[model samples]
Target chain A: MKQLTVELGERSYPIYVGEGLLNDIAATLGKHRIGTKSPLLLVTDEQVAKHYLERVKGLLEAGGYKVATAVVASGEKSKSLSVLEDIITVALEAGLDRNSAVLALGGGVVGDLAGFVAASYMRGVRFVQIPTTILAHDSSVGGKVAVNHRLAKNVIGAFHQPEFVLYDIATLKSLPDREVRAGLSELVKEGFILDREFVEWCDANAEKLLALDSAALEHALYIGCGVKAKVVSEDEKEGGLRAILNLGHTIGHALEAVAGYGELLHGEAIAIGMVGAARLSAKLGNPASIASETERILRQFGLPVRIPRHLDTDAIMGAMMHDKKFTEGSMVFIIPKDIGEVEINRSVSSVWVREVVDSLKEGE
Target chain B: MKQLTVELGERSYPIYVGEGLLNDIAATLGKHRIGTKSPLLLVTDEQVAKHYLERVKGLLEAGGYKVATAVVASGEKSKSLSVLEDIITVALEAGLDRNSAVLALGGGVVGDLAGFVAASYMRGVRFVQIPTTILAHDSSVGGKVAVNHRLAKNVIGAFHQPEFVLYDIATLKSLPDREVRAGLSELVKEGFILDREFVEWCDANAEKLLALDSAALEHALYIGCGVKAKVVSEDEKEGGLRAILNLGHTIGHALEAVAGYGELLHGEAIAIGMVGAARLSAKLGNPASIASETERILRQFGLPVRIPRHLDTDAIMGAMMHDKKFTEGSMVFIIPKDIGEVEINRSVSSVWVREVVDSLKEGE
Candidate 1:
């Protein structure tokens, strides 16, 4: 097992990524247990409920825990207020106290929503993440969890880290092609902003990854989670260095709003958003070669390199305006300075953004 | 103008209980601003919207900051996830970005709901509380914000401090009598747990307070907020000293759950809970005189000294099984050793509690 620490000071936690982590939870939680509460509330989305929920439940139960399950419907919609209420209610009914733990046992959505609930329930409770998908490699490591509200995605949530994250790559065997591809975006983002070798690794291993080869997937998950763990550790709450994790997310979130969430999985939107950022980087004359190569690698991975057909510049721009990166009226974009290097670029023009988005809408 | 500091090291924030804070928001947001984004989405319940919502809107707008409004139907229900969704959607539709601030402009309900939204939006954004009710005097000072979930109250939320709290005492005139009495419980709590003299002062002045006399009301709000400010500053996230703040909340929360939230205000439930805690403390030989004095004080102030007639002790006990304070099936109570000193008691027996609650029920 490889351990990566998210350095959030006293609020910091560790992310364990490797094969067979699900079984090692007892040992993982042993170090973090404050001995105040026992038993854990396992929070999973409906999709995850089928494959690994019972397995995790069994693990905790066999360890002498009175495990209670709070199964939320898996999707962006599950992050809403009513769902949160239901989850909290389940935990409470199950006799969860402040010392009791909440184990988030799904992908990004489950980790995020459940973590937020734990964060505020009784003014905060301990939580762990047993993430199942590749996309969760990033979400599980970062402490950000929330659901969409009327105005934006992740519009309501919190920045509370978990005590530990058990990222068992074996859990990804059931992941669909699209979901796997979606997870790659965060890896791609980690590489783009923090590490260059990981980007090159992705470029060379795209085919191996597309085939879902165990070795390639493991390597990707490790490196992806590694980069994420490094950045999040440095700046847990996106104070500064943490913002780098949001490389493609500024535009990616806008695309989600314009296209409607679930129209394109978050990774798909971010993949395309990265493309837009790459083009913007080129337009701004920062690192044309790196931008081109990055776009080339994403296209090979079967991730969308362009915005969807129906989404136009106006709607995308409108979404961008709502992003926290938006300053006055301009939105901040992360653009690659070199193949493995990225920089936060805040000077892109709206006219240029519209042009690129419109071009991408017309299928690249 | 009164400036209260909640001194929880990194999580420390100032509570500016004054009018015209909305006018100088820049000064308030001076240090925490990560970027130049100044536009904000003001979230308020209906009750506050009619009074000072536009005034705050005008202030921010006049400060050259673009402002958007997200209003939910007022009351406790507004803190529910459903209402958060509506507000978040409005923020999304209005183009709220990560740097954009969330202004919670109402009572504890709106502050908690909106603060939770602000805590999670874009992994987190800045939020300001412009409290318009007496209850907010307590809620706004702490970083705690949440919505009710099933099985418990405040089952979903976060410990995210607002960028600033603009507590215009002038706004409390519109508050109802019930809310005022309900909020007084907090002040009474501070005295019972941390300052016995403060509690005596409250018992002496509660009548002037009920009349909303300016001096009495101001003093009450100040001392109440001051006690919270001192405790929160020491333990922002309830790791230790912060638990004292919840002296009455644990049993109060159970009462709220069993009594049905709408049946009793938070302060009222806390009122009843405080009485129960005092009884427990007295039985444990911590302070027998204190318990009787507390009951006398609450009764004299027109607060309930007994559990609701329609409530069930078993159910309340069952509900508290979910309080974050419970560890290993043990309920922890923050009970007073004397009039001015509080201790976190973890070894309280359930049998004793049941008997006390049983006896209290019989008397009622």
Candidate 2:
């Protein structure tokens, strides 16, 4: 097992990465002092619940904790206010209290929804993140929990850190090939943001990561969560430095919005957006190879690096206008300067962004 | 104007209490460095908008802000997830960004609903409080923003502080007689918590306050907000000492829940809850005068010190079981030691609480 802590002072918590850690989930929660007397609500998706819900519940129950389960539909649509309300109903029914902890036991969607439930439940309670998908490596750690609006993605949210994140890689063995590749897009994004060596390592071990090799998966996730923890620790509220983590998110979120969320996975959309940002980087006089390299590495992992031709460019641009990054009449882009480092450019032109979106639709 | 700060270090903000402060709302927003370039959303209910929304919007526009207005139906019902979604839809349609500020322009209901919209927009945005009712002096200052679930009041909420609290006593002139008395229930609640002299002063000046004397209104609100500011500054997240502020809130919230929120104004519910707490204190070996004095003071202000006989006691007790205060099989009550002093008793028996509830239905 490998562990890293997101150092957020009193809000700080650890990320545990390993295979078969679910068997000892009870001990990890106890170590973190997660609510034993107050009832715990374990929120997961229908997909995840079918696989591990009963085992995890039994483990927690045997550890002397009373637990209730809320199973949401398994998709992006589950990240809505209505669904959040349904989960809160379960929480209220379960008799959860101020000291009660909410345990999220699925991928990014479950993690984001459950975390927001915890953040807003009685003005915030303890939260535990148990990420089952690779893409959750990004969303689960930063405390940026939210639900998407019809007009935009993650438009309604909060910065509520978890008590701890328990990553059991044995769960990832159940993910399909497409989901695995999509998840890798964000894993490699960690390297693209601050670690050139990690990016190279991801490129070298792409095949192994795709095959769910335990050793490679553990190492990459530890480093990915480390980068997220480091950036978030320094800028928890995204006043300045934290914007770098949104490197591909500005364009990526717009794509998700235009595609109506369910059409493309969050990681696939970000992969395309990362490429667009790299291309924009080159348009602003950075190395052209950065764009080519971002595209190459993403494609190597079987991820889509191009926007689907059928999606209208104008609709995508319209969605960007509503993004958190679009402030003061200018687009904000996290442009890659090189393989490992990025810069937060607050004045990227819409015309330039439009051209990049148009270009991503072309053949290669 | 009398001003004081809720000293939350980086999240600290000022609370300004006076008459007709709404006319200079833009200048005060500018002083606080709230967004000018970013669009602002002014949220009010139908009742408040009829009087102040147009004027506040005009003032903001005259000061160079792009303002959008959302007027919810005027009542406790506005504090629901469905209504919150409606406001977010309005926020989206208005193109509100991360830098934009949400200005709540009514009493506690509008403040809570709008403040929550700000707290959740883009994982949180800047928020400003423009309180137009006497009861708002308590709700607006503490940063306890929320939308109620069908099951409980404030069960879904967050602790998102504002840029500043702009209290205009001039607006209180338009309130109905019952509302004025109800608002006073909370104003004197501050006195009941930590200030014997202030409680005595409120008892003496009740007629002046109810008659809308500007000097009495301003003085009372300033001191009331001061007590709240002092408590919140010490414990921002209610770790320990802050629970004292829940002096009557546990029962108050349950009463609101049982009454379906709209039947009883928040202050009225809290007034009854306060009397019940004092009675509970006496049962737990405190002076009997504490209960009698509390009921007398609340009666002088024309507030209800007894629960309506029509409401079921079982229903109210059930609601308390679902409150944030009820944890680990024990009822948490903030009991009075004297007319102006209280203690947080976490292990109060539900049997005692039931007897007090039963007792409250009988006499004045």
Candidate 3:
């Protein structure tokens, strides 16, 4: 097992990465002092529930904790206010209290939805994230939990840190091939933001990660989450340094919004957005190779690097205007200076952004 | 104008209590550096909208702010997830951005609903409180914002503080007689939690406060907000010291929920809850005069000190079980030790709470 702590003073918590950690979730929760007295709500999507719900519940119950399960539909659509209300209703009916923790036992969608539930339930409670997909390696580490409104993705959310994140690599063995590749996009995104060596390592071990090899998966997650943990510790609320983490998110979120959130996975949209950011970086006089390298590496991992031609460019640009990143009069973008470094450019021209959006759609 | 600050470290903000501050809403917002670049959403209830909406909007627009207004229905029912969603939709349509400040322009309901909107919009944004009712003196200063679930009041919430709280004493002139009395319930609650002198002063000048004398209103609010500011500063998330701030909330919330949040105004329900807490305190061997004195003071202000007989006791008790306070198979209550101090009693017996509930419903 490998462990790293997000050093947030009193709000600090740990991330645990290893193989077969699910077997000892009870012991891990106990070690973290997540009490058994209050009823625990385990929120997972239907897809994840099919594989691990009953087993995880039995483990918690064996540890003498009362558990309530809420299985939401397995998709982006589940990240809505109506679904959040349904989960809250279940929590009220289950008699969970302020002391109780809401546990997320699925991928990014489950983690985001359940984390918001914990953040808002009784004005915030303890939360635990057990990420089952590679995409969750990034989402579960940071405290940014939210539900998407119809107009934008993750526009309704909060900075709610979890008590601990328990990532059992054994669970990733169950992910579908497309989902695995999509998840790797975010894992590599951490390297693009801050670490050159990690990016090289991800490039070298792409096959092993795609195959879900236990050793490679654990090491990759440890590095990926370490980058996330470090960035978040310094800028928990995105005051300054945190905006760098949104390197590809500005365009990526707009793509998700324009695609109606169901057409493309969050990681896929971001992969294309990273390419766009690199292209924009070159337009700002950085090396053109930055764009090519980002695209090549994403392609190596079987991730999409181009926006679907059918999606309208105008609609995507409109969505960007509604993003949290679009503040003041100009677009705030995370433009890559090189393969391993990025800068937060607050005045990136909307005309330049529109051209990049148009270019990405033209290819492939 | 009398001002006090809720000293929450980096999140600290000022609370301004004055006669006509609402007329200068633009200056106050600009003073707080709530910028004019992004659009602002002014959330008011229908009742408050009829009086001050146009004037406040004109002031903001005249000062160069693009303001969008959302007028929810008046009363407790407005504090629901649906209303929160509706406001968010309005914010989206109004082109609100991350830097936009959500200005809560009514009483507690609007503050809570709008504040939650700001807190959850794009994972938190800038918020400003422009309170138009006396009850808001308690809710606005504490940074405790929430919406009610069908099952319980404030079961869904966040601790999102504002940039500043702008309370206009002039607005209170329009409050109905019953609302004035109800709002006083919370104002005096600040005293019961910490200040005996203030309680005595409130008792002595009840007529002035009831008659909307601006001088008495400013003094009372300054002191009331001061007590709340001190308590919240010491414990922002109710870790230990802050629970005492819930002096009567355990029963108060339950009564509000049982009455469907419509029958009893928040302060009125809390008034009865405070009386019940005093009775429970007496049962726990405190002075009997504590209960009588509490009831006498609340009655002096024209507030109800008894639970309505029509509401079912079992339903109220059941609601208490679902409250954030109830834990470890015991009722967690804030019981008065005397007229000016309270303690969080975590092991209070359910039987004793039942007896007090039964007793309170017995009288007029």
Candidate 4:
């Protein structure tokens, strides 16, 4: 087993990465048990639970854990207030305790809903992520778990880190093609913001990784988690530099909101969001000359560049205001001055934003 | 107005205590609005909702905030999963947003429940406390808001600091004597764990402060918030030294669980819990003696020294295992060595705990 630390001082926890890490799940949770009777609960969405929930439960029960299960819907819509209450009520009715660890097993939706449940249930409880999707490579690693409120996505959440994250890449083989494509968006993000060489590697290794080539897939997982772990270590709560991770997300969330969410996967939204940002960067006259190159790479990965029809420009602008990063009403855009460098620049003008929206409309 | 900072770096926030803080509520919220749609949903219980909800809504609406209201049943019981879901659903249906702030207008239960909803809604939103009870003076000011999970008190919560805390002490004038005593338990925790001078002051001026004398109340508020703010600044998430703040919470929580919460006020349970802790501290031979004096001061404040007759020892022990602080089954006891000295001790034996229960049984 390979272990990485998130380095959050006291809130710090470990992320265990490797194949078959899921096999020893019970003994793993035994370490985080605080009280004598840790009435454990394993949370998964309906989709993932159909295949793997019983196996995970067996491992914990075999280790003598008194456990329970909570399963919700299997998509972004599941991240509503009703689902959160349902799971919380389940845990309470099952008599789960503060010392109890909530094992989130599914993709991003389950991890987030379960993590938010852990973050607020009994003030806070231990959360363990057994991320099943390639997209969870980012969401599960950072403690950014939350359910969406009506007006925004992830608008309400804490920077609560998990007790541990056990990423089993094998789980992704069962995922659909669209989901696999969605996962690539974060790798694209990692390449754009923190490491350019990693992007080049993704370019070279995309096919093998797509085919579930173990070595190639491991590299992406390792590098994606590596950059994310470092960033979360530096800023667990997004006080300043951490905002850079939202490089594509700012525009991406707007895209999702305009397209009415679930229309575009988180990564697809980000894929186009990155393009919008890249275009804005090129227009601002950067020294790196990073316009055509990024567009080509995105197209090569089969990522979309088309902004959805029927989406109003002003509506997207309004949605951008909902971002937690923005101050009062003034915008804080995390624009890259050059590739391999992202800055959380708060002094951007709305006029510049309007112009970019206009320029992109004609170009795409 | 007296202002103090919690000093949690970026998570750090300010506390405003004095007369008519609710009147200044709009101005305080103005500084943290994420958009022009800076409306608010004022959350309170049925009790405080009748008294201060309309007044607070009128103040905010008059000051130009698009205001709404959400009221729940008032009590510890209202902190359940169902109530939380109800509030989140109400807020969502009412168009609450990231730009919107939650004004928690009631005592500790309202502040904690509403604060938690803010902490988990859309991931999170900003919350401002318009505390209408004396207990809220301590609970609200420090940013430690939470709800009671089934097995333990304050089991589900987040360390999401409020955007601002408004300690309207004038609200304390209507507090019942029992509630006033309950609030003082936290105030007393500060003195017993960190401040000898404050403990001495409380012993000297408990009556004056209880009378709601402005000068005496201000002193207690200052000292209570100052100690908690300082501790929270150094350890916002209860990593290490923050555990010292637990002072009597472990045993106090156990007592409350055994006595069936709401049967005994939290402060009353904590008072008995402190005596139990003092006895354990003396037995541990950790030096510095004030076990007798601790009991004297608690009795003087009209607090209880024995767990209620309804409680069973073994049941209470089982409940402690569910405490958020429980590590496995062994208790993490926070014992007072002297008036100003406390420590978070791990692996407290169950054998000794039985002795403390036996000792309490002999007394009132």
Q: Residue A249 error for model 3, in Å?
A: 2.0
lDDT of 2 by residue, A1-364 (tens): 9999999998888899998889998888888877488889999999999999999999999999999899999999999999999999999988888889999999999999999999999999989999999999999998999998888888898999998898999999999888999999999999999999999999999999999999999999999999999999999988999888887898898888888888999899999999999999999999999999999999999989889988899998998888877787888889999999999898988899999999999473
Residue-wise lDDT of candidate 3 within A158-209, one digit each (tens)?
A: 9999999999999999999999999999999999999999999999999999
lDDT of 1 by residue, B1-364 (tens): 7777777666566777664455676456555562335557888877778887778777666656677888888777676767766776777766666667888888888889888888766667778887877777778888888777655667677778877677777777788877877877766777787877787788778788778787776677777789888887777777878888787787788887887667888888888788788888888887578778778887766777677777977798888776667777766888877777878988889888887777677365
Better of 3 and 4 by DockQ: 3
Where is model 1 more than 4 Å wrong at Cα? Answer: A34-37, A72-77, A257-259, A308-313, A362-364, B17-37, B48-51, B54-65, B70-74, B174-178, B203-207, B362-364
Off by over 4 Å in 3: A362-364, B362-364
For DockQ, candidate 1 versus 3, the one ahead is: 3
Lowest-scoring 10 consecutive residues by lDDT in candidate 3 chain B? B322-331
The alpha-carbon deviation from the true structure for residue B53 of candidate 3, after best TM-score superposition, in angstroms, is 0.5
Best by DockQ: 2
lDDT of 3 by residue, B247-332 (tens): 87888989988888778888998999999999999989999999999999999998888889988889989989878777756788
For each candidate, report its DockQ versus the true two-chain complex. 0.56, 0.88, 0.83, 0.35
Instruction: Estimate, for each residue in A102-137, the C-alpha lDDT of model 1 and write its tens digit.
Output: 888888888888887777676677888888888888
> TM-score rank, highest first?
2, 3, 1, 4
| Model 2 stretches with alpha carbons more than 4 Å out | A362-364, B362-364
**Residue-wise C-alpha lDDT for candidate 2, range B248-306, written one tens digit per residue:** 88889888889888898899999999999998999899999999999999999999888
